[model samples]
Target: NTLDYDYTNEEYDLIYNPLKMQGKKEVEVEVWDYNKVGKNDIIGVVNIDILPSKNKETQIELFIQPKNDKGEVQSNLNTDQKLGKISFSMIYIPEDDYLKRLRDAELKKRKTEQELIRQKELEEQRRLDEIKRIADEQRRLEEEKRRQQEALNAQYIKGYVQFKNISVSNLKKMDFIGKSDPFVLFKAGESSQQTTVAKNVLDYQYLNEEYEVLYDPSVMQGKHEIEVEVYDQDSVTKNDIIGAVSVDILPSLNQERQFDLFLQPQKDKKDDSSKSETSSTNSDKKLGKVSFSMNYISEQDWIKNFKQEQLRKQKIKDEIIKQKELEEQKIKDEIQRRLDEQKRIEEEKRKQKEALDAQYIKGVVQFKNISVSNLKKMDLIGKNDPFVLFKAGELTKQTTTAKNTLNYDYLNESYELLYDPAVMQGKHEIEVEVYDQDSLTKNDLIGAVNVDV
Candidate 1:
């Protein structure tokens, strides 16, 4: 038997029918180049020995030169010429072993299928968990938004409306007897208040009637209304609605406090049963009128206005205090400046008096080229810095320092001696002292002398 095919790639798997021989046998494999024009050319051929005992192992062989019909390598061709390679496996199994191998393969396939299904289930569960997480997050966000709106609306509630001195006039006659007993009812939103009945009168005035209603303008923007209904009292039947008037709250709040509401007639139940709609003429029938004083004041506005007034008063008070402080500081500064000027004037006058008295000195001690030689050292390692001091009565004068020199000469210096006839009438003794200057301590006195002036 021969198997032939065309393959385009490097790797391929081929299956062949079982060989007829058992145990061990040799199989010859041939490689050929196909030609469409004539017989195919023989590329190479190889003989491979098959052992049934090692059936699980595959044999790989490199092809050599082709063999002749005698089953011997061709001597005419170059036998070692390199060609392509081939690999194949041959297994021989009895009937029982073959059936066992098939069962094992089936079990492996089922295990692989079960593993794929488990992975799919895990993926689905993870997807569902992600969806639940997203849903929970959205709900939390919406709940937070709702709470924020609720908080905002709480601040939007403003204040209240007060209705006082309620009365009604010229109510319709509903009964067969005398003037109908009439009362007034005021309703706003979910709240209602009524007045005592004034029996047997066409006109009625309610005594000590007052109603205060809480107002939240955020919820009352366009829909809020006040309904004033006049009802006539009857002992045996339902109270008759003489008329009713509805006034929009926001506009009425802006208008004058006194309201004269002309009522509109109630719908007749008998007429409503017989017809689908009432005519405009019948619906426009006039009833009585209700009179009341309505007042609305926002507590938020009142508190804000009160705070502004307090702030204005406090600002005025602070301004007055600041002005007073500024005035007092200004006066204190003026007084200090005057005191400083007085001290400066006194100093100048004293200096002038000293100059005038110095002009009258009776005697003068003149110093020129007054030198000192060989003064003792006052420091650890330098020549003495020397100076001379002259004193006559209460006056003293000092010469300039000679600066690290043993000899110092007072080149230009003078001293005046006052001759008070009461104290020093004549010759005064002048004291001359030579000293070494030490900045860190007292001056070191070296010598002294008295000179008669």
Candidate 2:
């Protein structure tokens, strides 16, 4: 094939075959002027010779020789014939060396391609890691913001609700011999407060009993509903659930709210009565009714009003003292009056302290020498790593983990928990839970037991 070009200067690298020559060989070069007419015109030709004993590389200059149409060199005519000069280099290579060089070049090409692929993979991995880091940071920021808002809401007290004048009437009788001894359980969210039991009566009035409900996001999440349950007190068996009712607390936030809720019977009562011999006729009717009043106390306004009232009382007391001084009363009488006033103040303080002290009964409970036997095997390589957790009400404590033993004893593992009887009611049992510790995941529970305190 012929290569055509339309430029004044050009360069090209060419490879030539030795054609299995042993001693010497001859090579010819030709140039031609392409034409669109009939026959093509020859520009010039050069003849070269190659020998086996020549150098590896050689440079040559083009000296055009004129030739006839039959391809014979014309030595008779000697006019300096030249179009453009060209120079080239020629290298001689043997068969074995040529094959080795070809293989090395191929190997280098593959290594370069593999290196580029590795760099691209590393770049992609870095980009993915950066994306994951950004996502994690954003999640952390959102969690922090939520926690801060929750803290702010908990610190601010919106208002208070005074639940007073509480009473329940016409409760269902749980006992065969006498009327039921009933009590009211008031629960808001996870926290609960109850009134003292009323002994053996169909209707009961809580004269001096009152519950103060504070509005805070941490406790009740801003005016959530309150759940009321009535139960009959029993000596032996579990207490019987009489009825339940839910009271809305939103109205108490605006003004003094009054509630007259009719209690509904327990859900499983009808099913139990169906199995009983003497089923009452009023089983499907309303259980009873509860009447209560709630007075909303705005924290800011109540504080301001209380200070004003205190100032007014102080002024009145001052006026009275001035009038007593102007009357020219006896000195002994004045001393006696002052003594009586001091006694009144002391009595008031005593009553207030007693009222506060009645809220909780603090008690200390100690656990010691805890052990567990026959724990389930959780690990394939060794015995279970077991620990004991003691939970009483809202308090919890745990024993140290004993490693690689079936009959493990946590000797001298003692703990203490403070319990409030009023808040916990009759749920005074300590829950003992056994667990197997794991390094890669959550601890597995083995067994549990409850001990009554």
Candidate 3:
């Protein structure tokens, strides 16, 4: 029907929750006021149009019109009728975006969760010092010291793995080349990456590549194996795997250990009968050998100390960042304090300047000429008697009563109103009110003029 409720001081808050406008892009929202004393009256109504864009955000404005019954428009701003205005701007988002917004929020939450998961994983990794056994530490250190002296010439080494050479097996001479383009591939760990391949070993330049591995000593003590494979690269066909080799990672942390890794055929290939020269060697060719050496240097103390230094630097940086944040917070607090002080001063000035009245005024207030017109007929004889009392704008009331100008009008009277300028200043209105002298009845205020002094 019609909305009609008087706005009271008890209920000042007006909040409109999400007005789900469905999937419609264009909708009209109307606001009406129907609070009259005895009946309902249409104060105003406005139609809101929703304008939405995907790439850019926008805003819209609608004007409200005050209307009375019979759909006629009216304006009441200048009159006593105070049907206050309402600023209505509705950004109608379609309900179809509910899932989109939910998905976006979910995506953000998942990303945050993923980052936290990675951080937890890094923290969970086993540390060397944490796993180092206290009982065996002394013996391990003593034994590592002896190896350190032996490796001192290389000087403060971490660890190094050397790949020497590879012997092939069941190798087929690829195509018309009559020579196999052969190379060896080797790596450590589970991931296929980190494989150190041999260079310059087309003939017999063994021990071509070296890989320096950083391992946690106190955490890792078991033998880690190095996997090696030999490949025959053909120009036209897919590369043929000659064989594969598995070599154990060296155990010593200081002195290097040398060993020979035997290679075996990865897959059985058809025997070539025409190559009678290689047929005799085919049996020996199928089985091959790979020579390699792995070395380790016990420098856990140096690595540990360097890591500690880096951690100290990071701690210092974190402290600096924290201090910067605190300083920024302090600056923000200071700015807010200044703003609050400014607001307080402005409020004080507003209270003091509420009225255009004077704080102190000094001047002679003398009623030079006095006249009373349009006097109400009194005394029952159609005759009137009127006199005037002059007062200034003050609490004590700078007042002066003039003698009755008997009959209907007053003679030109000059009365000096003693005004204390030490108490008041600024504009003071001289109020001249006319009163009829009635000994039996109280004095009647017929009219008054707020005169400027």
The candidate that achieves the highest TM-score relative to the unseen native structure: 2
lDDT of 3 by residue, 394-427 (tens): 5322223333433333455577665664454544
lDDT string for model 2 (1-453, tens) is 444345456555334565554443656667777789978877777666645325477786665677877896554233357644435666555656667877887888888778878888888888899899999999899899889867755544555656778898988778998998988887655666788898999799989999865554466654345667888899898999888765655556647777776677555644422111112322335577777887656677667766988999999999989887866667768888989998998898878756755544669779997888887898888988899998878889989988887788787678998777765655657888998898898998988989867
Give the best candidate by lDDT.
2
- Model 2 gets an lDDT of 0.72
lDDT of 2 at 95: 56
Q: Write the per-residue lDDT of candidate 1 for residues 189-304, one digit (tens) a residue.
A: 66677788888987878878888666655555433456677899998999988987665454444344777766676646574222111123224345777788876556676467
The full ranking of all candidates by TM-score, starting with the best, is 2, 1, 3
Full ranking by lDDT = 2, 1, 3
Candidate 2 Cα outliers beyond 4 Å, as residue runs: 1-157, 221-223, 266-284, 301-453
- Cα deviation of 257, candidate 3, in Å: 2.4
- Please, what is the TM-score per model? 0.28, 0.31, 0.23
**Model 1 misplacement above 4 A:** 1-158, 217-222, 252-256, 267-284, 299-453
List all candidate RMSDs to the true structure: 40.0, 44.5, 60.5
